[model samples]
Target: MTVYWFMMAWVILFGILAQVSARKVCVGEYLGEEVYESRVHLFVAVVTFAVIVFFAGARSYVADTTAYIKMFNDYPLFQNAHDVIFDSSAREPGFRLFSILIKTYISDNYTVWLSIIAVISGICVMVPLYKYSCNFGVSAFLFMASCQFTWMFNGMRQFLVAAIIFSCTGLILKNKTLLYIIIVCILSTIHKSAFILIPMYFVAQGEPWNKRTLLFIGCIVLAMLFTSKFTNLLTDVVEQTDYATSVEEFRNTDDGTSIIRILVESIPIILAFIYRNRIKGKLTPIVKLSINMSLIASGLYVISKIASSGILLGRLPIYFSMYNLILLPWLLRNIFDKKEKDLVYYIMIICYFFFFYYQMEIAWGGLEYASKILNVKY
Candidate 1:
C-alpha cells in the first residue's frame, strides 16, 4: 500500500512537470496548417501515463479486476462458452474475450494475468488520447487528467472502449464518419455504452442546434421505459456477465432534478449556439453538449438521494466529461500566460486534485477510501 501511494505521488508530480516543460500545442496542426509534432504527443503520453498510473495504482484492484477474477473462477463460462459469437453479458464481450485469452495463457496465475492485461490495455488506450491531445493542444490533456478519466480507471473494459472513442474523435471530427462508425462498432463489443456515442459522434460532427435534438433523447427515454423488453439490445452484456443478477433487480433509483441538468447543460449548449462559429475554434457542439450534460448530471446526483445509487445520471456526465480531457489543459495554459500564472496554475492543479478526489468520494465512496488507503504516504 505504501509503495503504491509513493508511485501515485511520483506519477502526479512527474506528469505536471513534463507538461510544464513542453511547448504550447498549436491550433494550426489541427487544421492542417502545420504537421503534428511527435514531441507534443510524447509529452502528453508521458503525462497521461503518469496521471493514469496515479489513479489506477493508487486504488487496489476492485471493480474491473473483480470482474476478470470472476470470469476465471467461472471456468464453465469460458469453456462451455455458449455465446462465443455475441456476448450478451453486462460487460462488453470484446474485453471479456481478451480476458479469456489471457486466462488460457496464464491459467494458473489469474492475478498476474489481470495486472498484465490492465497495464497493456491502459497504455493502448492512452497512446491514442495522447496523440489526439497533441493534435488539439493542452485543453484535451487537462480534460483527460481530471476526474472524468480518473473515474474510468475502475472500469477497465469500459474505459478501453471510451478511450478508443476519445482517440478517434480527432479523426471523427475531421469527417471520417465511416471509419468512426467502424471503430465504434468494434468498441461496442467491449461496452454497450460505447454505442450511445455513435449517435453522439454524428451529433458532434455537426454544428449546434437551436432546437433540442429530441430524436435520440426520445429513443433513450423510450428504451429506458421498455428496458425489460429491449433488455436484449440495451443491456444484454450485463445479463451475461456477473452483473446480470444485480442489474435485473435494479430500478430507476434516480429522482433528481432535471432542471439543474437543463441549466448546467445549457452552459455549453448555449455557448455552442451563441459562439457556434468560434467554439469551433477548439471544440465541437457534441463536446460542449457532453460537458454541460455531465455537469448537470453530477449536480443533480449530488442533490438527489435516491438516484445516488442508480448512478445512471453519473454515467451521462462521465460520457460528457471526456471533452474536458483536452479543454482543461488549454485553459491552464492560458492562465499560465496571465499575471499570477504560477500561483494560478498551482491553485488550479490543487483544486483539480481535490475536486476529483471528492467527486470520486461521492461517486464511489468505498473505492475512494480504498485508494486513499493504498496511496497512504506513511
Candidate 2:
C-alpha cells in the first residue's frame, strides 16, 4: 500500500504538471478537419514513466508477479530454444523470445528482466497518452483510479501486447486498416488475445453510434439475455484453444464483475449520451473513436456482469477500457457547459477518490510493493 499510494500520488502530481507544460500540435487531417493534438511534456513523461516502470519492475510479489518470475527463472534460454518456443503446445513466442534475449545478453536477475518489460509496457502506454490524450492530468487520474494500472502489476504478457497496439492508435485514426491488422498479427504472437483487437479496429472507425457500434451493443444484450448459451458457445471455443485445460479448472464459477466498476467505467459513455447532440458537431476523429471504444468497454463490462462466464469475459474489456482514459476528460471538458463544469469536476473527483479507496483497500485488500533498490516494503 505504501508504494502504490506513492506511485498514484506521484503520477497524479506529474500528470497535472504534464498539462501545465503541454504544447499543441496537429496530428493529421480527419475528413478535412484538422485533428488537434496535445504534446505531453517530455520531462513529465520521463517522471511518470520512471515511477510506473520502477514500482512495477521492482516488484518481487503481486498476484502473478511471482509466477512470472519463476517462469522467467526456468526459461530455457538458447538451450533447446526450439523445443521451448516451437513446441506445438507452446504459445506467446514473442514474449518467450523477448525474455530469452534479455537473459542471453542482459543480466539474468529477474528484477532486471521485469524492469525491461516494465520499460516496454510503460513506454508503449505513455507514448500514446502523450500523443492522444487531450488532458493528460485527467487521463492519468483515470488510468490509476480506474485500476487499469493493475495490468502492469498483474498481467504483463497480455498488457504488453495491448500497450503495443494502443501506441498504434494513430494508425486507426489514419484509417490504415491493413497496417493495423498486420501490427496486431505480429503482436498476437506475444498474446493470442491480441487477435481480439482486429475486429475492434473496424468498430472504432467512422462516427460514434454507427451501425457497427449498435451491433456491438446488440451482442452485449444478446450475451446478457442468453448467458447460458453464450457461456456454452464460449466454452466450446475455449476448449479448442490453448486455454482448454484452464477451462476445466472452473467453468462459470467465479462471481461476476462488481457493480461499482460497471458504474465507474460507464461514466464517460453516460456523459456522452447526455451530451450527444451537443458534442456531435464538434466530434473529432480521436474523440469519436474514443467514444466508440468507451462504449465497447462499457458493453463488455455489462456482459461480464450478466454472462455465466464473467471472469473470462471480464478480462476482455481492458483492451477497450483504456480509451476511456482519453474519452472521459474530453467529456468533462466539452460536454458540460461552463456553468456546470466545475461542479461536474468536483463530483468526479469525489467519486473517483472513494472508488479508488474502495478498490485499493476493500477490494484488493491493499497493494504491497517490495523493492531492494528503493528499500521499500509491503
lDDT tens readout by residue for model 1, 1-378: 233234346556555555565555443433645532323446555554654544454444555655555666664345655475265434556766766666665664554554564465556556644654432333333443243444444566566666556656566557787887888788777766667666565544343342234444454466556645644453454445434555545544433334433343333333334544544555433354443443333332332222332333334444444554444443334223566657765775575556445444544463432443344322
Off by over 4 Å in 2: 24-38, 372-375
Candidate 2 to truth, TM = 0.93
> Scored by Cα lDDT, where does model 1 land?
0.49
* CA shift of 287, model 2, Å: 0.6
Using lDDT as the measure, which candidate wins? 2
lDDT, candidate 2, 214-292, per-residue tens: 9998898888788889867877875675456667665646566889989999988988988898888777778899999
Range of the 10 consecutive residues with the lowest summed lDDT in candidate 2: 241-250
lDDT of candidate model 2 versus the reference: 0.81
Cα-based lDDT for every prediction: 0.49, 0.81
Residue 173, candidate 2: Cα error in Å is 0.9
